[model samples]
Target: MAKQRKIIHVDMDAFFASVEQRDHPEYKGKPLIVGGQPNSRGVVAACSYEARKYGIHSAMPCSRAYRLCSHALFVPPRFDAYREVSNQIRDIFWRYATEVEPLSLDEAYLDVTYTEAFNGSATLIAQAIKREILQETRLTASAGVSYNKFLAKIASDMDKPNGLYVIRPEQGEAFVAALPVGKFHGIGPATETKMHNLGIHTGKNLREKSLTELTERFGKAGQYYYNIARAIDERPVRSQRIRKSLGKETTFAEDIHSIPELTAKLLDLAERVFESLSKQNLKARTITVKVKYADFQQVTRAHSTEHIIQLTDLKQIIPLLLEKTEAGIKPVRLVGLSMSGFDVPVLQTHQPQLDLALNDEF
Candidate 1:
């Protein structure tokens, strides 16, 4: 029999808020919000547990959050500080696993199937890492241990604000079967609604549907659902996954209908994308512009050039792309710019085949 893989998923609890609380002792035990000023047109990036009590959460409007808890302290993000702490946490991950996949600044997956630590116990490894994170950063983290990325990621969220959970291979199927489809790591609200419409509220209900039926409804993602329902995910814990694209978007407080206003916003976004490309020492041949109308209708237009794109080219191309959308005819609520088709060589890996699907939830 082949050796079973052991994977551990670690996620810092309320990372931004925790860091803020730890750095400023005065904010400890108080409701804190991170991301924009309460009066500004911004959303919550992260909030402390105390803030959650009032129903304040990430991505919520800062204005709504203020209404919920007027006394809550609001602070802007400090990315440099977060990056420095992330490096410290990753250094600890390397001590226990050779394959460490960082999902973000505050979360990662570690494969320790062959390590000698704790007699190859993934649970012990998780505990040790959490202990070390607390000791070094004075912050708490939650961990999940399982045989695959899907299960491990789900297990990590079973508890919150500093918790650990594990799922063994023998228990994987039953555990998944009993779970709500919405609780699955990769499943999002839209998929959950579709599943519910099909009378598939739980994993067992999902498992009852044929792969063909699922694929017919969800396209390629159906196959992914079928396998995870059976506790089968063959995606490997990749150590070096290269990013294929980079982009950023901004939402306006009020909708704009004039071409000049839209062009000005696009200019700012283009500059931001160009700065990122320069910092990464990368160039691209494709530029995509995304526009969202006041009615919440969104459209994306892409322009490709034989030669690599330059900052000046973006400034010129954006105005042309805006014509593809009803930006001037209908008020626009958001505008974004992105670049891909990099000049750098791409990385390739021979991945194990099990399910060819992904979670668009994030």
Candidate 2:
């Protein structure tokens, strides 16, 4: 028999908003929206649990969130604070498991299959991690323990703030069978809509379809769907998932079609991207510039240097990169800059094809 891997998914509840509350006790026990101001054109990055009662959520427009809860406090994100907390949590995770895959600043999956901690019991390790987090950060986290990443992720979300849940191998199928298709982590709104149209509302409904039939409907993702429906996700908790690229972008409230204006935005984005790169201690040989026009059209251009890039080099290369696009002539709505072609030596490297989105800011 194959070895059953022990995995744990740990997620900080209301990460950004909770950090805000932790720093400012007055914000606690009240609806707090973190991202941008209500009058701004940006969206909510995250909101407190109290804010969720008002039907507010991350990615919703701050203005719309304001309309939903007029009295809610809107706060800008402090990425530095969140990043620090993330590092602290990561340190806590590393104490128990060596193989940890960070999904975001506030969530990660830990493979503790070979760990000597808690007698190799994933449940005990999760409990210890959560306790350490609360004691160290004064923050709460929810954890899910299972034999696989998919089940662990699902189990972690089964409970809310400061909760722990588990899914044994034997109970995996029954647990997934009763789950709503939309509740699956990888199934987004679009996929859920398609699944619902096909009468695949629950895992049970999904398992009823043949792999060929699903492939005919869902394309390549059909194979993934078929396997997950059987609670059989074979993907490992990969710790060394290398960084593909690093970039930053911003959307404007109004479009501009002037070269001078676009140039200014490009410089700002370059500076921001460079700052991020420096913070991560990364260097790149390639710099990419993305432009989005007011009509929802987008374009990108990239230039590679002979050696690792510097901020000064980026400044000169950005204007040249912009020349590859029609940004000045076309009303530009957003601009982004990214640095890839990392200097780190790896076993294998794959440069992702650039697909600049029409409406996406980054």
C-alpha lDDT (0 to 100) for residue 180 of candidate 2: 98
Off by over 4 Å in 2: 274-333, 341-343, 347-362
lDDT of 2: 0.87
lDDT of 2 by residue, 12-109 (tens): 99999999999999999999999889888778999999999999999887889999999999998999999999999999998988578899999999
Off by over 4 Å in 1: 294-297, 348-362
Give the clashing residue pairs of candidate 2, or none: none
Q: Count clashing residue pairs in model 2.
A: 0
Clashing pairs for model 1 are none
For candidate 1, which ten residues in a row score worst on lDDT?
353-362
In model 1, state the lDDT of residue 176: 93
Candidate 2's displacement at residue 150, Å, is 0.9
lDDT of 1 by residue, 106-175 (tens): 9999987766677778888899999999999999999999999999999999999699999988899999
lDDT of each: 0.89, 0.87
State the lDDT at 62 in candidate 1.
93
**lDDT for residue 317 in candidate 1, whole number 0-100:** 92
